[model samples]
Target: MAPTSTAEPRPSTTAYRQARDTLVALTGQHDRAVAEFRWPEVGERFSWAIDWFDQIARGNATTALWIVEEDGSELKLSFDELATRSDQVAVWLSGLGVAKGDRVLLMLGNQVELWETMLGVFKLGAVIMPTTAALGPADLRDRVERGGARVVVANAADSAKFDEVPGDYLRVCVGEADGWHAYADAYAEQPHPFETVTASTDPLLLYFTSGTTSKPKLVEHTQVSYPVGHLSTMYWIGARPGDVHLAISSPGWAKHAWSCFFAPWIAEATIFVYNYTRFDAGRLLDQIRRAGVTTFCAPPTVWRMLIQADLSGGKGDLRELLAAGEPLNPEVITQVQHAWDLTIRDGYGQTETTLQIGNIAGEPLKPGSMGRPMPGVPVALLDPLTGELADEGEIVLDLSRHPVNLMTGYLGDEERQAEAMAGGYYHTGDVAQRDSDGYITYIGRTDDVFKASDYKVSPFELESVLIEHPAVAEAAVVPAPDPTRLAVPKAYIALAPGWEPDAETAKAILAHARGHLAPYLRVRRIEFFELPKTISGKIRRVELRDREQRAFDGGQSLSQEFRDDQFPDLKA
Candidate 1:
């Protein structure tokens, strides 16, 4: 894309490749890799598409992408083909006046055009603002306005959602739509040499954080922050060249880019995708086997569902398994291991950064622990009160070490940036505990942790215990007001299939929790209610906390709630 430079590989590009290869070589030696790895010095001007992708793609027939549809149709593209196709797409977009630094709102599902357009936009040095198709007019309007989107590329069916969204940005659709430029027209353009316009520090992506606590913040990532920084992610995933890496993630989210796009590509692995309207564990397992997937990653939700379904058939070709999104419950991990003889290594990161910490492949994994700090990530835990490094505290990256994986900061919000980077560290807001062996385990968010009866309570710890019960499918724990103790733990639970929301079920669940958890961490109240979640499927504990506080202030109790006192047999 960058004029097909006749010259040799740039110093920066060579450094990047060497760094990636080193990680690939050090896959099984986790400690040695972390101790020895260093971030490559990518100089001022750099374009990942032109420098990294295109260079590796030339004359290479290796599969770069593989997508399997729900209806059994499949598509495969070689690295060379994708490179040339993206070049033509870049030419066509340039023809439509889409230039460098123009912000484009990308709202498409798991389609080939999405990948093509992404690469093309990267080639042109434009910023991508990926939005989920599930968003309605209100969210779309907010993203378009806040992201300062100047162009839109979406599925034809999604074009009408923009009718109520007032904007003068250019519209392009993958399918036939009136007043929208046809995305298929890109194939009509001939591949041509293009000049690179991106700098290492230029904003390449604007991601809207899934708002679990408050309004979603617009996180801006520079070219090097993701494209180059995901070296850590690639290492964590244990992906290698020629491997087919499949990750369960929806479009428009940061994890989608982390696993589905950047990390796998960095490893020179084929990115495998399976699209299904509804999740069927049996069918998903069949696809994994059929595709010969070597590396796989999914959120904890998927892992839970898979464990509930039968896994006795066997793990097909999966060598490395990973879980992220939220902390993976130990029960889910244990069940999977019992069935497949493979452990699901949990990872930790945010929309603002790549994989900062993870249970690296072939390393000794501690159940319920997210693992050590990833290579090249300056991870530390700072005590909230003392503002110093501690064994258990808020997770932060030492800015003094210069963390390249982190975002530039919240876009257009200097105040928030200043607060986040205060005390010479980039605050992660999430709390965690580090063992003497250097393994860091996630606790909960700073806002989600609360004091009950003078003891600190982590909602994740309680929820993890609750889900271990047979009747509980999903659970969210929040602090409810108490008469004597300042607060008490209250669980909002979703019942498993065939489980009734009745006194007997609640009593059994509470008894199970009492047996597993410490007395100070007892769940005092529980309500059989569906858990609220963000569009990304993360449980919204903030909303549950608010609901509990409101009910307490009004001196009213939810009729669906069952208190420990009501279950007299629990005292036995």
Candidate 2:
């Protein structure tokens, strides 16, 4: 089938190219250029719609976005068509009392409706609180209430979740459903081009972080925070003009919005998404080949699974590959680089901010490092003891410099913001180790660190080592119940191919850990079990730590594979 047609306007060649190049050079090692980097200053008479989107949509008529299916079903929307469609949706939503600055919840899957609604909401200057289609009632309720959402655009299948969530917000559903606004109806309405009534500093985006240990916190971003902040993200992901880029991430998370909306658009790259019910490596590879995807990014969990598939399959039209969301293990990175002849550049950031550290296009990628700080992000490693810059400590952002990328502060919690932004810096609460070359390698969460004797241990360091072991399919390291050493580093391991949960397997892994680790960091206990992960596929160490706390609840209930006393020969 032919692609969609349009008569949309395009940005000035100079401005668009300037935006593109600025993003690419943000990660370069230039002190003067980076220090001078500031948020693109705009007036209160600001509107990304008229200033940015309309300019870009001025003369573009080709397919600006495409979503192709495995069975050859495809959907292409041109820049002009998208602009017109979004204008109509903006008009329709305005008629429904969806006013500028009003918070609206966007909860949809990879359907075309998501794009239409996102643009429509932006055009109307409505602050978007994006939710995932996978969200349950509990998650949705917190979003609507805490976010003060006035309207919600969600998939029809997820409409049932709203039943349990009490809210006075307007409910609009895509796909087939009764008593809901038909999103396609907007096409019948005339496109009423709009200019935002709000300022650039006003709230435009709000994200809820995954609360692994506590309840989720609401993170607020301004109109400029994401729109301009993603310049670094675009640079980090190595997106380019006319490049078909794919970033595999769920909707609710910040990573999705980072690449799906701002980063690719900032680069003028055609955002390509392969929508499937579940992740399939072969299917994804086929999709990548079919779409000619140049820049590909996915979480480490997806990369881990992708490597497990037959890497000997078709080498798709891939130019750049990247991994984030979790620390990419060196073994996983090495496997893909060797197989596909493509390096998986690791990146680091949080829901509260944009890309802070990443191996950008121009940099030499040191495996297992998340690269140096991006331009405009004044990053420092703060010592935990005195909160001073250190060689190895928490990754903190210096707020003294005027940077606009950070969240406006956690919603309704000035005290929390004060604490996080204390010590003249913004604490990330994630630990890292910087080498002499300034490459930052992720250690683990500050809370996840434990003590084995007097030595400090990073759970990620131990888990990374365990996952490299042939017998370990997956692993989670946390403090184990111990009598003498206070707490010992214990690993819950998942067996790889041909490995079984038996005395022989346990003995081999224990022996392997002993051989690799220092005396203070040895895996004192090993449990052969599948690891539990969060919705985003991060290992839920909080849950594991709780389990260890209860292990000593009854009589000393150590893990079945645990053997602290069995390895006497190595200790001797």
Scored by lDDT, model 2 comes in at 0.79
Give the range where candidate 1 is weakest over 10 consecutive residues by summed lDDT. 1-10
Model 1: per-residue lDDT, tens digit, 214-322?
8899999998999988999999999988889999999999999999999988888899999999999999999999999999999988988898899988898999999
Best by TM-score: 1
lDDT measured at residue 253 in model 1 versus the true structure, 0 to 100: 99
What TM-score should be assigned to candidate 1?
0.98
Report, for every candidate in turn, its global Cα lDDT versus the true structure: 0.91, 0.79
User: What are the per-residue Cα lDDT tens digits for candidate 2 across 1-572?
Assistant: 12222334333333434655765555454444366555555555455555566556645675668987656788998777777788888888888889888998998877677777878888888888888777789878878889998998987887888888887888887875766777777778888667657687888889888876667788998877777777778878887677888989888778888888778877767889887876788889888887899999998778877877888875688988988888888999899878988888888888889989888775687867888888778889999998779989999988897556788889987888898899889988899999998889988898898887878999888877777778877888999767788889988887877877987787777888877778889998888777877666677889889988887666567547658577565432
Clashing pairs in 1: none
The reply for model 2, stretches above 4 Å from the true place, is 1-19, 25-38, 564-572
The residue-level lDDT of candidate 1 at 12 comes to: 80
